[model samples]
Target: MAKQLLAVAEQKARQMGLACDIAIVDAGANLVAFHRMDHARIAGIEIAKGKAWTSVAMQMPTANLAQSALPGGPTYGINTTNQGRLTVLGGGIPLVRDGMIVGGIGVSGGTSAQDIEVATAAVQAFAAAHTHHSTGASRTIR
Candidate 1:
């Protein structure tokens, strides 16, 4: 699963002509697979991982997190409280299968929306692959 996610992400990154740092994290927010494009910023790797970890750990889109972490939101302190492991910015998305979150994908070193687009593409690719191999049916992962 980790390899599949990484492959799809890497492919998308290449196709989009964007250098990126991609990370895949398990449900526990542990790193499973990671890749840094040849020209990507070294720092983006960790940031991407942290964003993905935040998504899986919080079970919400990173964009939503960004909103919640605004100046006066309930989770404003989250940015400083999670040991810098949580990022409220965009680029992270949880991967769900069979109504269960399997892991997450994060992309960094690009615009926020670009990061989200790549990560979302990876998730969609994974879903399509899984569906193609299972009972000739398809399922949507929320």
Candidate 2:
């Protein structure tokens, strides 16, 4: 699962001319596989992993939490919660099976939009490879 997601993310990143660090984590928020493209920023290594972990732990895309978590917002200071392991970055996406998250994928070393693009592509790829039926809809908890 991680291998396919990494391949899909790497290919998508290259297509967009981005050097990304990608990470995958299970439902338990445990690390599974990780990859940092050549010339990728050193900071992306931990950032990507954190994104993946955050997605799995929160059961949603990290981007969804970004706005509300900002200072003065409803979830303000959430970034400081969980000992800073939780991030509100845009690169994290949960992998779902039967409407339940089985894992998550994260991509860093690019703009939030670019990271989302790569990570979304990886999720799409995973959905395609898996035999489980899906509605192909985005998950939102608002």
* RMSD after Cα superposition, model 1: 3.3
| Candidate 1 lDDT tens digits, 51-88 | 89988988977988887789899788788867877888
In model 2, which regions exceed 4 Å deviation? 132-142
Q: Judged by lDDT against the true structure, how good is candidate 1?
A: 0.85
- For each of the candidates, the C-alpha root-mean-square deviation to the true structure, in angstroms, is 3.3, 5.7
lDDT of 2: 0.89
Which candidate tops lDDT?
2
Q: What count of clashes does model 2 give?
A: 0
CA shift at 118, candidate 2, in angstroms?
0.4
**Per-residue accuracy of model 2 over 35-110 as CA lDDT, tens digit each:** 9999999999999999999999988899998888988899888889899999898999999876889999989989
lDDT at position 60, candidate 1: 79
